[model samples]
Target chain A: SQQGEEDPQALSIQEGENATMNCSYKTSINNLQWYRQNSGRGLVHLILIRSNEREKHSGRLRVTLDTSKKSSSLLITASRAADTASYFCATLLRDATNKLIFGTGTLLAVQP
Target chain B: SAVISQKPSRDICQRGTSLTIQCQVDSQVTMMFWYRQQPGQSLTLIATANQGSEATYESGFVIDKFPISRPNLTFSTLTVSNMSPEDSSIYLCSVGAGKTEAFFGQGTRLTVV
Candidate 1:
């Protein structure tokens, strides 16, 4: 079963625009991580935010986590055509096994 | 970070047949898990492969349909039994240490006809 739900199933934008994706979870989590997957390829780890942390930044990617509301958001700034991919948020629940549960994912298309 | 590899990146099989996907990690890990993702769908965890013990399955999944084997900490296998068209999906293997993020394999794209 999926623990996280991401909004905006698909997004299309011109290059240099920003893209933001949100994820909401049903249970308490130890940590939340974001991933990007190109077509027909394995997922690439983007950033991970622990429950104790409110926000984190990596290169052009920014992630924010709110434990109280059980939600997280990933923001990509100055997006490029190469940044086009499916973004997913995975949650590691505190009560469940150590397995990571992923969301439906948001597909972003950056037109050059 | 651990490097994970899966065999037969993609394959097409007939119905009622079985396909065994292999997952190998570069380093020994304590936890290994299998996940299924249908086209345009979210990932669904199939089971957790524990070395020296039976794999633990998630709800809506059974060992009979998806038999998993963890012969060692560095290697595991998942077999989709009696596959059908509905079984067509990408299967991924992941490994993690404790509460940290997991490393995933490239995934095996299976098409059952």
Candidate 2:
């Protein structure tokens, strides 16, 4: 079953600006991960924030996790047109099986 | 990270026919998974492929309709049988090598006529 629900289903922003997306899940998770997918393509792993980590960063991407609220947020700094894509947040539940439940996703369009 | 190669990248098939998409991974993994993404919708897990055993299918997915084959640790295949127009979507194969991160292949874009 789908657990994560992303807000701001679609967003448009100018280049050099920052974009933020939020996600909420129903169940507890081992980790929350963000991914990027260009049109008609595969997903690229962006960043992963463990349950123990409140926040983490990689390059210009920052991710924050709130296990108590079962929510997470992704912030992209200095967004570029190339960053335009559908971003999805996936959760790995505490179960032993490595199944990932994906969110509805947020479509971000970076205007040049 | 493990590299996955999936094919045929895209295909157009008739309603009564079947299409088997293959996924080959560079490194061995304990489990491989199949997911389907409908038009403008999020992906749904179809099944989990485990080596040397029958695949565990998810709810709303059946073994008769979506058969999965995991021959080894690094390879698997998913067959969409007797497909209909509704089956037209992106089929992705994924594997988790470390922690909770998964690696995906360029998905198979299937269009059932």
lDDT of 2 by residue, B31-56 (tens): 99999999988878999999999999
After TM-score superposition, the amount by which residue B110's alpha carbon in candidate 1 deviates from its true location, in angstroms, is 0.4
* Chain B only: TM-score of model 1: 0.97
Give, for candidate 2 chain A, the lowest lDDT window spanning 10 residues. Answer: A92-101
Give the number of the best model, judged by DockQ: 1
Clashing pairs in 1: none
Please give, for residues A36-102, the per-residue lDDT of candidate 1 as tens digits.
8898568888888999999999999999999999999999999999999999999887865787889
Once model 1 is optimally superposed onto the true structure by TM-score, how far is the C-alpha of residue B38 displaced, in angstroms? 0.2
Error of 1 at A48 (Å): 0.4
Model 1 DockQ class: medium
Best by lDDT: 2
- Clash totals in order: 0, 0
